[model samples]
Target: MLWTIIGIIFVLWLLGFLFDIAGNLVHVLLVIALIVFIFQMMAGRRKG
Candidate 1:
């Protein structure tokens, strides 16, 4: 779920970087995704 969204955002960020589109909004997405990822990691959930 969250991982999927992160992967998609990453791909979009790469494409935007390669094609030079969206100017800066795509970078904002990258920053947002990084923050979410860090938060999720710090939350510390167990699957056992």
Candidate 2:
């Protein structure tokens, strides 16, 4: 589920780059997704 969200965001980010559409929003979302991914990894490490 997390991976799917990240993949969608990545695709949107790429499209934004190529078409110059909603680039800022897509970049922000990408950053947010990355932060979430990192956080999840850190939390998982703490549990294990």
Candidate 3:
């Protein structure tokens, strides 16, 4: 679930990086993905 979303974001980031499209919004996606990753890690730590 989370992996899928992260993968999508990563692909978009790569595309934006290569093509220089999306007008800086792609970096926003990267930030969101990082935050999501951090939150998930924290949640997993709490659960375990």
Candidate 4:
């Protein structure tokens, strides 16, 4: 579930990056997604 959400966020981020939309907001969102993905991975690793 987390992976799926992360994947969606990644695709959206890629689309935003490619299209250059939303200006700084897109960049901030991309960074936030990255951080969330990293935190999810870390949590998953600890659980495993």
Q: Please report the candidate that would top TM-score against the real structure.
A: 2
TM-score of each prediction: 0.84, 0.94, 0.91, 0.65
Q: How much RMSD separates candidate 2 from the native structure?
A: 0.6
lDDT against the true structure, each candidate? 0.88, 0.97, 0.93, 0.78
Best by lDDT: 2
Backbone clashes, each candidate? 0, 0, 0, 0
| Candidate 4: stretches off by over 4 Å | none
TM-score of 1: 0.84
Worst 10 residues of 1 by lDDT: 39-48
> What TM-score does prediction 3 earn?
0.91
| lDDT of model number 4 | 0.78
- Tens digit of per-residue lDDT, candidate 3, span 1-48: 999999998999999999998978999988989999999999999999
In candidate 2, position 19 carries an lDDT of 97
lDDT of 2 by residue, 1-48 (tens): 999999999999999999999859999999999999999999999999
Q: Model 3, poorest ten-residue lDDT window?
A: 21-30
Predicted structure 3: clash tally: 0
Give the Cα error of residue 18 in candidate 3, in Å: 0.5
Which portions of model 2 miss their true places by more than 4 Å? none
Q: State the lDDT at 18 in candidate 2.
A: 95
Better of 3 and 4 by lDDT: 3
